[model samples]
Target: MIKHIGVVGAGQMGAGIALVAVQSGFETSIFEPSKQAQEKTKAYFQKKLPPHQPLFVTQLDALSNCDLLIEAIPEQEALKIKLFQELDSIAKPEAILASNTSSISITKLAAATKNPERVMGMHFMNPVPVMKLVELIRGLQTSDKTYHAVKATAEKMDKTTTTSKDIPGFIANRILMPMINEAFHALQEGLASAEDIDTTLKLGANHPMGPLTLADFIGLDTCVAILEIMDKKPCALLQQYVNAGWLGKKTGRGVFSYV
Candidate 1:
């Protein structure tokens, strides 16, 4: 019976999640501190979402009535913890506070809140509007009721759910990021050109896109950040690309140039 969904952050993932929430018929509120980001999200929604306007708030106080608040901020542990602490104090007592973290520990994040039972991970894949799988991660103290409620909500949004214990990267990225990293290694070692590496995976593995190409789409800097959070050593070449500010399609350059 969750309604009045609130989403913090108005970046790519946050905007996508807010779009899904509204499409599912819930009254949605989006909180974004940056006016520039808010403008971008507004333009996106005007073009892609229903004509009905969603409340865009500049402060968390507006989200107090939300039954489910999903934090879609950048993947930083300290920032997430701070936000959760504030959310725990602001949101309704029974509200479920979820994080869309890709690699961070859900349990650790839950600890920041007073009511750990209401804290869990609702990790949506990139391009949230299109992706079907939503990883429902239960932290150490996440209640069964909270887990089921979020699962049902995901289903209502036409998304499939896979449950996982709170672990680094949960289920998806623990395996996916490493493969992307390996693709970078192959390119760095001169095994093949970026195009050839991707073509091999596309034809041999039947993947929709090649690893290098996918890396560019996902953003090279994001890939390195996830690997580092998981305590995995990132590919040196990937590091170099990030250092050069070639953060993939967002920056118009990465493993392959989009420019």
Candidate 2:
């Protein structure tokens, strides 16, 4: 029944979600405070999408009447709570608010909103256009109606939906980040070059992308932020690299460099 969608944050995830929604024939709106991010998001869809997608949006205020609002901000609890508070006032009484948080607590996030029953987590993996599975997480108070609604929304977007319990890192990233942290440790011990480390995982683990490469795609700053919250310290290599502002592709540098 939800025909319109709103996406907050306009980061890689938000823009990608907005593209998916608009391409699926939903009227979509996206909110991004930074003028640069907003412009980049718009460009991403314009250049990356075919002409058929009705990517009709100019600014943030278009979100108020959207049937579902997707929050795809950085992984910060305080900021997310603040956003929910604002959206609670702006969105319609029956609109569903979904957070695309990979590691944050869905229950805690749900409680931050005025109506917890209307809030839930819909975690889409990176490169949204390509990822097939979408994790649907229900908070303690998230209504069953919201679950089905979100699942249906995912289906409409051509994504397979999987249910996850409210927990730290949910499914993929919990196991994934820890392994990546271990990889950092290996590098600091002079086990291998960054490329060698990545290659090892690709061939040995039969994985498509190495952890460091995946981390870069996820944004190294985001990795640092998540690790800080998890009380995890990567090998000293990452600490020093972070100090150099070599966060990742977002900054044109990481384990691998990008121009």
Candidate 3:
């Protein structure tokens, strides 16, 4: 029954989610105010999906007709709550509003809207087109009807779905960030060289990439954000990287130099 999908923000996660939505045969509308971001997203679509085109607009009003609206903006709680308040007014009475937040509280986000039942967390993984899992979190007021509808929609995108309670960091980040933090701690304590630490994890733990490499890929700034919101304190080493504007792969330098 969910035919049209609206995506806010045309950044990496947003573009990836919109691409999958189009591939799943849903009518998609994406709102991105930045011309640079719009061009980047367009280029990405042209490269990955040459034929299909989702409606792209600079104004939020263009998404009024969408059956489901997914917000894929940055990981800032205040910004998200403000957007949700505005979306509550613009979205249809029955349309579902979902957030792609990694660690923020969905129940708290739902509190910003007039009808909380329809708001839930539809946290898609980074590089969404390639990742297989979609973590679905139900807010305290999220109804069964809303949950099932979003689950079916995610399945249509060919993603495996897992349900998590509305907790800080939810399931994926709750487990993943702590291990990543510990890796930063190890590096800071001079337990091993960055290369050695990464190599040990890759060879010994059989992980696809070492934790530092994964953190770089995930963006050091994002790691800091997720950790700051979680119950645990962020590793000082990680914050230092973010403080220096070394946000990993995107910034060309993080724990290691990519330049």
Provide the RMSD of all predictions against the true structure, rounded to 1 decimal: 1.2, 1.8, 1.2
Model 1 C-alpha lDDT per residue in residues 1-259, reported as the tens digit of each score? 7988999998888999999998888899999998988998999999995746689987898999999999998888899999999999999899999999998888998998889999999999878999999999999999999999999999999999999988788899998999999998998899999899999999999999998888887778778889999899999999999999998886788877777
Candidate 1's displacement at residue 45, Å, is 0.9
Residue-level lDDT of model 2, residues 213-238, one tens digit each, is: 98888887777766766667765777
Q: How many residue pairs clash per model?
A: 0, 0, 0
Off by over 4 Å in 1: none
Estimated TM-score for each candidate:
0.96, 0.94, 0.96
RMSD in angstroms between candidate 2 and the native structure over all alpha carbons? 1.8
Q: Model 1: what TM-score? A: 0.96
CA RMSD (A), model 3: 1.2
* TM-score preference between candidates 2 and 3, better one: 3
lDDT for 15 (candidate 3): 93
lDDT per residue for candidate 3 within 164-251, as digits (tens), equals 9998999999999999999999999999999999999999999989999989988888898899899688899899888889999867
Residue 141's lDDT within candidate 3 is 99
Question: Which sequence of candidate numbers ranks them by lDDT, best first?
Answer: 3, 1, 2
